[model samples]
Target: MEGTKPKAGCPRAAGRVGESGMEGALVWLIYQRAPGVGRRRMAQLMRTYPDPEVAWRLGKAELAAVRGFRPDIVEALLAVRKSAEARRDAERELERARRAGLRVLCYGTRGYPERLAEIPVPPPVLYQYGPWEPDGRPVVAIVGTRRPTAYGLAVAEQLGRELAQLGAVVVSGMARGIDTEAHRGALEAGGTSVAVLGGGADVCYPQESAALYRQMRETGAILSEQPPGTAPRPENFPERNRIITGLSHGVILVEAGERSGTLITAAHAIEQDRDLFVVPGPVTSPLSRGLYKYVRDGAGLAVSAAQVLEDLGFLPSAEGPLHFTPRGLTELEQRVLGWMGSAPWWPGDLAESSGLPLPEVQACLTMLEIRSAVRRLPDGQYIRIG
Candidate 1:
C-alpha cells in the first residue's frame, strides 16, 4: 500500500482510511446530500471517530454510544448509511463533480486549506473551482451590505484594491454591492481573491455576477460548502459567512446596517478569534449603523490600509520597509523617487527640479526614508538605497 495512488474516481480519505480508503469522501458526499445532516453534526461525529471511514464502520447500536449525537442525528446517520439509494446519489453527485473538473476536497486532502480547518465545525467537503494554492501572502475578508451607498462602494473597492496591491489575498462573499466592488478591485489590481458562495460552487447566485464569477475562477477561486446544483437559499448565507471569515486572518466590515447579513460574518470572525476592523462611515448613512457600532464597541477602525496591515503585525510602528509596494507609494513620493539616482539629491534640489514644493518634497523624503527606499545623508541629502 506504500505507493498506492488514489485512482481516478476513487474517493480520497480524510483521516484514517478503512480497507477501501474511499469511505471518507463517499460518506461525506452522502451526508452533504442527506437531509438532517450538516456541518455541526459531521463535526460531532469527527470528534468521536477522528475519521469518516471509522465512523462509517459503526453500526446503529455502536453509533448510539457516541455522546452529543442527538437521537434524531443518530437516526439520520444510521438511515443514510443503510439506504442504498443514498449511496448511489452520493456517487452520482461526486461523479458529476469529477466530470465538471471541479476539485472536491475532503477535510484532510493534500490541497485543503489549513486556515479553514481551524474553524469550529468547518465544512466537511469544500467544493472549489479555480486555481487555488497556498501562498505566503496574508488573507483578509471584506464584507458589507448588498445594497451599498456610493460611499460604501467606494470604501469597499478602495480597501480591496489597497489590500490586494499589498500582495494580500482579499476574501469576500460574491454578493451584490460591497462584495462585488471588492472582488472587482482585487481583479483590477491584478491580485488574488477568493469568493465564498451561498449557493453551489458553479452557480453564480446573483446572475449579474456571472462574468465576475468566471473571472475569479480563471485567476483565483470560487468555492462553496453547498453541493453542485444546490440553489441559493435564504438560510445558506449565514452558513457561507463562517467560511469567509475562517479563511482569513482578519475581517473588514465596510458597511452594514442593523440586521445586515454582514453582521453574521462579523460574529463568525469574533468566534474564530480573527481580527475585526470596521471602516468608519458617515453617521447619517444607515449603512454605517452596524459598522460604526462595532467601532464603538472596540473594534479596530480602518482609517487607512496601513492601519490594518500594522494591526496584523506586518508593519513597523516606527519605521522600515513595511512590505512597501511600488503601487502603494504616494503620488508625491513617486515623483520624488523618480527624481533620484545613485547620486544624493537634497530635498531643495528635488523640489525645484520636480516642480513640487520643498515642504512636500521633504515630507516625501521622510516617508521614503521610513520605507527604507532612501537613505538620509549627513547633509540632509537623500539617496535611493533600495
Candidate 2:
C-alpha cells in the first residue's frame, strides 16, 4: 500500500485534484448551480461549513442540518456533483478569464471589496478585472434613466464633472443616457470614475458604450459580480445595480421615471442607508417624475454639485453657495416652484409624468407636504415649498 498509487476511491485522491483556492472556486461553481441558492444563502452555508470541499463531502442528511437547506436544495447539490458538464463548463470559463486578463474575487479572497463585506449578504463570489482600489475616499453613485432627456444628460455630465473635480470618485452603471454621460463627464474632466457592469466586466452591454468602457478600464475601472464571459441577462442588471449602490456613500437619482430600474438602484441605496439625492426635473417630463417624488420624500435636492458636496459632509458647511433660510409657502408656491427652471416638480404631475400609481406618488407627496418642504396647490397638485 505504501508503494502503490492511491485508489481513485481514496479521500486523498480527491484531495489531490483541486487545491485550496481552486477548490473554493469549484464550491462556488456548485453553489451557483444549486437551484434557489442565492448569494445570501451561499454565505450562510459557507459560514457554517467554511470549507467547500468538506461541504461537498456531506451526505443529504448532513447537509440538511444547515439552515436554508431544503430537499430541493439537497437534490440540486447532488445533481451539481454528478454533472460533469458543470465542472467542464467552469473550467472553460476559468480558462477563458485567464486568457482575457480578468481576475476573480470570490467572497473570501484578499482582493474582495471591504465595503461590500459589510453588507448583510454580500456576493458569494465577485468577478472583476482592472483597477479596484478604494483609495480611502468616499464614492458617490450617479444613476438615472437609460433614455435620458437632454436636460437629464446635461445635469449628469455637469454633476459628474464637478464631483470629479472636487476629488469624489464618480460611479455609475455605464448604461446609456445618464450613466454614460456621468462616466464621460468625469473622464473628460480627468477624474477617476468607476463603471459597474450588469454583465461580465469584460463584456460591454450597450455596445455603444464600448469606447467609454475602454476609457474606464484605462483611466478608472469597470467592475461586475458576474463571472467573466457571462452575457448580460435581464435579471443580472438589477442585481448589479445593488452593487453600484453598495459601493457608494450616496446615490444620485438624475432622471428616473416612477418605474425606472434606476429607482430600484435608489431603493438599494436607501436599504444600504446611503444618502439619497435627486436632481429636479421638469414635471412635464415623465423622466423627472421619480426625481420629484424623491425630492418630496426628503431626498436632497441636487441643484448644483456644491449642494451635493455640502450635504455629504465632503465640504465644510461654509464652502457652498450661501445657505439661505427657506421661505414659507403660499398659493403661488405651485406656479413659481413649478416654473423653477424645469428642475423640480409638483406631485400630481410627477405621478402622471412618472407613471407611478397614485398611492406611491401621494405617499412621497404627503411626506414632502408635512415637512413644509412642499406646498399643495389648490388644483390638488404638490410643488416644492422652498
Candidate 3:
C-alpha cells in the first residue's frame, strides 16, 4: 500500500524471457555458482556493480579492490569466471529453467517484488513458476506447524478463505498441515495464493502436495530462490522463511510449539518490520505457547481475517466487518444478515425466506453473531445489530 502502482499503459518487464533478460539471468546464475558467494555477498556485489555484465568483465585486481570483497571471495569469483565448467553449469541451469517454463527474476529488475526488495539481502534470483505478479496488493502470510492439531487446521483454512474473499493474496510455505490448508482454502475461494518453496520452483516437496502444487501453478504461483534441481534440504527452510515474511505485508501465526521452526518466519516478520498477528489457540495445547508469547509482547491478536485486514489498513475503518458489509462476509452470511432488521426472526423462518437450508441459515447466524453483526434475543430469535 505504501508504493505507487505502475503507471497505466506501461508494460511490465517481468516474465519477459527476452535476449537481454536471459543475459542478465545468466550473469546472476554465474555469480550464484561461485563458492562462498551467498545471498548477502551477492547483494553487496550487485550494489557495487549494478550491472552484472560490467561485473563479469572486471579483472581480478579490480574485483579485489571492491569493498567487502574479501580476498577469498575475489579469488572465488575469479575462479568461477574462468572455469569453463562453471559457465557450462550456469548455461545448463538456464536451459533447464527454460524447458520448465520458469521465469527467472534478477535482482533490481522491474519484475522483482517491491516489498521483497525492501528486505536486507533479498534473493539474487527468484524462480517463479506461475503468472501471479506483485502489483502492490496486500499480501499476508499464514504460517504454522506442519503437524498442527484439528483446531489449528480449521483456523488456518478459515483465515485463508476469509482473507482471500477480501481480495488479499495469501502466502505460505505449502508445507504440511496448516500451510496446506491455507493454500487450499484460498484456492477454493477462487482467490490468489502463493507458495514460497524451500526447494526449486519446479519441485514439490512432501510429495503429498503434488495435486495442490498443480492447482497453485494454474491459479496462483510457486516461488523459490533455489535453482531448478535444488532439493528441499532442512537448512534451506530456515533461509526460505525470510523470503516468506519479506514478500508479505503481514504474517499470521496460527499454531506453533515452543521450539517450532514456524517461529523462524515470525522472527523474520519482526526483524523485517512487518505486522505480526497471532491466533490464540487452546491454552492447554503446546502449539499455542509460542504464539502467546508474541501476543504478550504486543503482537496483534487475530480472531478473524477481517481483523487482520483492518489492522493492516486494508479495510476502510476498524469499526468491524459489518460496517464494510459484503467485503468480509461469506455469501450465505451476507444473505442471512440482509434478511434481518429491527424485527427478530427465527432461524427456520429466515432460512425459508432466503430459500436456504435451515442448518446453513443457523450456521450463518452463528458466524454473524460471533462477528457482532447480529444479536440473538432471549427467545431464540436473531436481529441485525450492526
* Winning candidate number (TM-score): 3
- TM-score head-to-head 1 vs 2, winner: 1
lDDT of each residue in 1-386, candidate 1, tens digit only: 21456544434433233322234567676655556776776766656675555566677777778766677877787677667787787776666566566677666445567778778878877778889665435688889998898988998889899988877788999899999999989989998889999888978878998888988899999988877878899999998999999988789998888989999999999899888999887888888876776777778988777679768655321222333223377766765665664468878887888899988888888888888667898887887642
Over 145-246, each residue of candidate 2 has an lDDT whose tens digit, in order, gives: 988888999999999998888777899999889999999889899988999887888898889988888888887888887778788888988888888887
Q: What is the lDDT of residue 322 in candidate 2?
A: 19
Q: Which regions of candidate 1 deviate over 4 angstroms? A: 1-23, 32-36, 59-65, 315-386
Worst 10 residues of 1 by lDDT: 316-325
Cα deviation in Å at residue 297, candidate 3? Answer: 2.5
Each prediction's Cα RMSD? Answer: 12.5, 16.0, 14.3
For model 1, what is the alpha-carbon lDDT of residue 229?
Answer: 77
Runs in model 3 lying further than 4 Å from the true structure = 1-20, 58-67, 316-386
TM-score of every candidate relative to the true structure:
0.74, 0.70, 0.74
Give the TM-score ranking, best first. 3, 1, 2
The lDDT of model 1 is 0.76
